[model samples]
Target: MRLPCIEIIGCIAAIVTVLKLVTLDTFVFGDVQETFILFLNVHFLAALMVVFALAISAYKYLRLGIELMPIEKYVFRILISLAAFTGIWALSTEIIRYFNYQELTSAKSVSDIENAKQLA
Candidate 1:
């Protein structure tokens, strides 16, 4: 049996969510490039990709007008929910990591330095 479009979308959302998070980290952590730091922080490029996906999906939905069948509708919901959850998790993780990095890099304390460079 074919899977619902929503479920498929959910899977794609989940994967894309992870990708987005990883890309964000590359910017926030300063691991990617210090020169283009502003670009990463703003994430205009990623935002564009996200907007494109949503726009395409919306356009298709409007054009199809319920021709997606029950499965497809369910898939859409599942996809959207998965993406949302991934986003929440990514944001929280980034915040936590930021503070951890700040404390470590700032030379706040023995523990902070240790914690910050714990991976190193």
Candidate 2:
């Protein structure tokens, strides 16, 4: 049996929220990069679930000719859009933070090398 679009969308939104919370936890606790892998995994899973839901919804509507109720139609649209937007936002934030962290560490290493050269 095919699932309703709203249910699928709700599941996606809930997953995304949970993933965001996990990432927030890492950010707040000063966790190591290894621990941050959990956050990345959560993000990946959330994105995957959203994509899967969209595909299922499309197949059911297009192939099976199933229709959603008025409220479910609008809410599904909003939830899917929000899920895509927030997923992109979260991923980009993580990428920017990673690059910034890399830049800072590299600069510090370069400065340390120069200092050692002067001391030798």
RMSD, one per candidate, in order: 8.7, 5.1
The sequence of per-residue lDDT tens digits that candidate 1 reaches over residues 1-120 is: 435666466557746755765565434645423323332444434543554465455455546646777545654554455445545554565465556556555655776778879878
TM-score of every candidate relative to the true structure: 0.46, 0.52
- Candidate 1 TM-score, C-alpha based: 0.46
Residue 56 lDDT in candidate 1: 53
lDDT of 1 at 17: 57
Q: Which segments of candidate 2 are over 4 A away from where they belong?
A: 1-67
Q: What is the lDDT of candidate 2?
A: 0.55
Candidate 2 lDDT, 1-120, residue by residue in tens: 546676666556655664664465325324333334534654445555655565455444444433655544454455456556655765765675566556666888999999999999
Q: Which stretches of candidate 1 lie over 4 Å from their true place?
A: 1-59, 62-65, 108-120
lDDT: worst 10-residue window of model 2: 25-34
* CA-RMSD of model 1: 8.7
Residue 35's C-alpha lDDT in candidate 1? Answer: 28
